[model samples]
Target: MNFREFASKNVHRNIKAYFAYFFSSSISAALLFSFTMIIFHPDFVKVDLPQYLIKALNVTTIIAYLFLFFFVFYSVSVFLKSRYKEFGILYIIGASRKQIQRMISIENIIISSVSAIVGIIVGIVFSKILLAASGKLLGFNALGFYMPVKAMIITFVAFVMIGIVISIFCSFIIKEDMVLKLLKGTKKPKAEPKASSILVIICITLLTVGYYLSITSSTKTLTNRIIPVTLMVVVATYLLFSQLSVFTIKLLKKNRNLYMKKTTVLWVSNLLYKIKDNTRMFFLITITSTIALTSIGSVYAYWRDKEDQINRDFPQAFFLSDIYDNKSKVDSKAGFIEDSLINQGIEYNKINEELKFVIPDGGKDNVVIIKEDIYKKLISMLSLNANFSKEDESLISNHKVKNIVLDNVEIEVVLKSDRGLIPTFYGEVYVVKNDIYEKITGVRGYFGAFNVENYQDTLNICNDYYNNFGYEKEDKYHNNLLKSRILRSTKVAYGVILFSAIFIGLIFFVTTGSFLYNKCYMDVIEDKKKYRQLNKIGLTYKEIKRVLNIEIGVLFLLPYIIAVIHFFFAISSLRYAFKLEIKVAAFRVIVIMLIAQIIYFLIIKKRYLLEIKKSLI
Candidate 1:
């Protein structure tokens, strides 16, 4: 009679509602918590570069919201279907429409709120996990994980708001007549005619063209990206699902053995029915699987690239450079370093560390503005452009123009040798090469590069350097952001993305795969009558399993094959999105994805077969 009693009853009635809540809240919390730790990283405070990266990472919140929103929205629909009959009951009970609406509203709001709270707690836990993971990744001591209460509030507020909004919208469904509907199941909508074969072929052709553009695109120039590929994949994915399911069913109908069998006709009919029955699920599976494969693969690729890059940054065993904030100090530091190297029993075969200035040539598309201080430091550590131009002066300015970067910048430099000097000239600066040091801008800077004899020894030297000059030891944070590309960086960037995607994809494949599994198992469950009738005539369990296996294989493998092919071309279409130069990257990406795909298929297939065996038993 009262609100509390009504609420308790509603809660008891809807278990799926709770699951929806749990999934939504948990996913949201995880992303928010992880992001919070990433944004104001304690480790990054000392490392100036990470601080900037942290800032950029925060901007990706929109992406998280989009994902969570889809998850929660779709879950509500699924939950509703399970409880639709209950609404019919309420309608039959002679409850006033207003009363029914009130009850449903209370139920939805309560479920959403409870779910959001649980999600935040789970998120808090996941935050700790992510922080710990990041610590290992950066090779830093792990801090005791703690939630940013403020972040908790923000996540809590946002998801709660989303829940309330979704619930309020859901409440309106109560207005539908519920009583008479209780006796009859919801009416099935009439199916549309099958897509025209010619139209389907035309679409396939167009999708092929889209894919061709992606694979052929030069990735080096940022001319390509994920957008086109993603779109192409989506369109192709849906079309393939529609076309393949229909065409295959029609093909099987033509086979005498397949069509003439008693229940085989029914099974075939069911397959055609499901092609219509599972349209929404098909769309979801297609997209989710594609994203998953790409995401998991991308993360590993990105990480590997970073590792390769760090290794390539220094190839020798041991090397050191001077520490200074200006040209004069830099020259003196070079002397200090040279003396230290000699005193330390180190031999240098060639000039290991060279200095140059990276000046920004501003442009619209550039996301990373490689500033003077950062570039100077990078160039000093490795051999860079010797030419300087008036553009190089922009490095001294607070806002450097990135468009001009790698453009018309003049450089001047001199090469020092025991017997002679070689001078090089560029736009503005004159070369004073052939000395103990190379000067860039004659300004105070802490940027330099090095190559060493051995990696481990160099690591130790770096440790010592960090002990002296690392984040905590440094008095202030420098805002120099320099970006570099590793040959494998693209793969790595996509690897982590691929990992999350695959994690979700695997979940989706398995979950939806269940429906297919169930269709096979349903025969076993309902076989008593059908078998009794058949036995009166003639049949065996072995024959039954054989027939069932064929049916299940067609059902399971058909969409999967279509999805796999769609994903391949879809991935190819991504060429323009990533601006990937070196088409070889796509090949490498493909190989990695294939290896992972095999691994994933093996796992899911094992689960599917287990279900089949369980059903047969």
Candidate 2:
């Protein structure tokens, strides 16, 4: 037969083995194509989004393309490794090394071409839905659907390049291995694995240190420690599976009761060897699971914290400062704003506040002082029932630090006032009694905080007010406009990240599942001998099934459990660092991931038993 025909037949015959690689490559290409389509979408460009965000999307698309190359290449390599025996058999049957290489290359080309075509088609169909959703999130009035020929061409070319790269890579891999090693494949038996106490200790130390750093680092200090902490955690995670797990399992094996039990002995013996051999793959699974959890959790947390974030960044819809000194100006501006709001039939509530800045001897600067009565009035107006005694000092700050506190108040100012007077020292707001505030010789100002029924409508009124009389006081709608602008940018950024995280997470998940499946399949050849021996010793099919269940279950769940532990600490750090209320988001991420993992485990288990049962029979 011609090599092309042989390659085609081989590919068809080994469809199950190729399923994971093909699906992953195709899905990755689809994601890349979809994202590229967004970047070059004709309607997307016509939207009123920022150029920088568009630029960011372009950069992300490029990065995604680069990432997919490595990802697809890795899956292909794994798939090739699984078929080493096939190549060896061909060689033994008088097929030259070049023939084998050619066959593999032809197979890759055919598979990749088909996968890429399917991927691009799927991506094109989904890009419209993605763009429509993104448009709504970005506050775009319209992002009409149209085919992006440029994006399609880019995706097609990039994936084709990847296919070529994989083909070349496979050739090199084949050339490096001896014919005997290829024939033996991954089934070369070795002595039982021994745990390294030093490695176990190092793993424990690293994990402890990493978890400590993650949990204890404050919001301000986290960024500095993040890299080192991540490195330590990654190294530790590898060792945890590779060394610590082996050590612990060995210790458990020493227990006669658990070790000598019917199927436990069968599974445990297999598991001991399997765990040692599969450590690296287990580490990969754990890391990817952690990535999926953390990425999805972070995205959900940001979305969940949106309201608080808005309030923290933009305290009020409109803020009028230093209006006390000029009553006429204050009356004019406030009257115009209220009149405009009334004219537009927009509902809003207004608060009159007297703000004072105290020049403190030490601590922080930019501190605003307000009378306790005003504080109580604000609390009452907000329907908050918190009590503040005359002696107790209340602070309003975005950050929570030592010597800092929070009240239900939001203050904004710097050392320099609009009148160009520089305060000697200012810090956080101090809600003090009227007597203490009066004694401080503080710089006083009129502060008006406006809350609108409709944020956009109120922002429009504030903008109109700014255009009329409050232009000099840019602080009013600076926060509003800044808030709107930031929200738009954040929606886009988070939307992109969320979609990417979910897509990539699913890829990693599927890839990991496939890894486990491939490992099981590889073990099948070796396991046949072991099962034959067990059957001679009267090991029943029921017992064999139980062993297979335990084996696959442990292999599947160990990494997942470790990853969940890692995510726990990670989300904890995010909570403390960003001061985010992430319980709901965390809960959602955990539940969804658990459901997905269960489904994947069930599928793998069913297939694995079917394969192993053949050996048992």
Candidate 3:
């Protein structure tokens, strides 16, 4: 056959090889495109977002893509290995090495092209769905809508360039096969875990220390040591897998019941065989699982850090400030009118007050409003760690308390504020004050939240407050406050869910994909047992089918259950590592994660079972 004819024939006859190669290339192409689109987006130029955010995202995307690049490349190698025997047969059939190489090259190229087309289509759908979801999450249904054309073009160009180059590389690599090597195939040495016990010990020790370091991480010292401990943790996890799989399997086997129960005996036996016989697959699965978990943990931590910021920084639910240079047409006293509609149990603290304005002659920086002697005690309460002298201390004790205002602002700016001090009056320990304080204060804004009767009431009140917010004439102190709070909370929820889902996806990608590749690889080595023999001796094809289902089900479930438990301990370790002192809201987050995991598990399980059925046939 000519090269084209050979490729078409080979691709049709060995459809699995074609598929493996295609999917590998497709994922690589999609990733490259995703990175290119996210990093070089033109719309970022027009958006009113920060430059640092774009730069950060660019760096993050590059790092992520690099990881994915290696991921795709490794998967490609697996596909190549799976085709070893077929290539060997082609070489033995009086085909010159040059002719064989030409045929193989074209086959790979075709496979890549087919896979890339499918991946691009899938990626576009994913991107569009993400955009719609993000828009809803952000509560501005109009904003951040994805235009796929630009992204598609960027992804297409990126993947095509990379795919073409990688295709050539794969073709060239395949040419290294001698007929004998293909016939026997490349045999990896079984894992010698007993011989590597010392290395395993070191890896385990290092991992333990790394975990300890993370757990003991002080929030105060978190800035300096985060990188080293995290890196060590990652390295140790992979190393542990490399050096300890044999040791672990042996330990598990010691439990006779575990090794003997129903399908458990078969699973354990098979797993041991897998770990020893398929060292490369074992390594890939471990590496992929660790990466998936770590990525989720890291991203969730980044997002959860915001919780501390929000809970500590903002003391008020409603903060309405005076907008500059605008005359009020409506009575600002409309708040009191609104208050009258509520029952006695509802406490409406209407705080209408303006602080004396103090600024350096030119309005260059944040203008600090100078507080009156009357307001000094109130100011101290807003900023934590605020200490006033003995004179101010006496004033606090002697000053009468009719109302308390929870003035929440940008914490740092609040501390360094440099407004002129309002003029002092002698010993005027005033009793009750009226609306005069509100006018003099310019009613810059109200800073208060409702202490509602119940939790649902709290949500209703907060939502109402969030909705009523608008720019007032004298209000300019901290408008970024609203967006900051909303974004912080939204990002926490988003990052956790997003990271978990992506991690699970990666696990499926690495794991189920690895299992498929392994089966293909073994089919070459295992053909000595004829398909006819496999059907003999009480083992029907249907029995093989049932066994395949059980094996796959075990393969997916065992690691997953372990992963969830490990993740809990892992996050608990996170709190200890960061020294973030609080009882974690773990139950709620876990519930959400479990729900998502169940959905993802079912989808992947269904697809995997379908794929397994195909692999068997």
- Give the candidate number with the greatest TM-score: 2
**Model number with the top lDDT:** 2
Candidate 2 segments whose C-alpha is farther than 4 A from its true place: 38-63, 89-97, 124-145, 148-151, 320-336, 351-365, 371-427, 433-448, 454-493, 615-617
Compute the lDDT for candidate 3: 0.47
Computed on alpha carbons, the lDDT of every model, listed in order, comes to 0.48, 0.70, 0.47
What is the lDDT, from 0 to 100, of the residue 19 in candidate 1?
42
Report how far residue 89 has shifted in candidate 1, in Å.
Answer: 3.4
**How many clashes does each candidate structure show, in the order listed?**
68, 6, 18
lDDT of 1: 0.48
Task: Give lDDT tens digits, candidate 1, residues 407-522.
Answer: 44432222211110111111122222222123223222343323434433333333443354443322211221111222122333333244344335444443444334333333
Query: Sorted on TM-score, highest at the top, how do the candidates line up?
Result: 2, 3, 1
- The digit string of per-residue lDDT tens for model 3 on 1-617 reads 66688677877887654454455456655654444443334543444344555555555555555554555556556666767777788777776767755775666556655655766676666765644443443233422445557667655555455445555566665654466778876664555345277867877887677667656665455566667765665566555555576678778888997777655665566566554554555445544554455455545554555545344334333333333332132223235323532643454333334443322233333232323433453443333333333322212222222222223221111122221111111111221122333333322322222222222234443444445644333433423223233444555355434433453444345334545444443443453243336555454556555554565554444444434443544555556654443234444444554565455455544554455444445
Worst 10 residues of 1 by lDDT: 417-426
Flag regions of model 3 displaced more than 4 Å. 20-45, 94-98, 123-128, 137-147, 175-177, 186-195, 252-267, 277-280, 297-308, 314-376, 379-570, 577-617
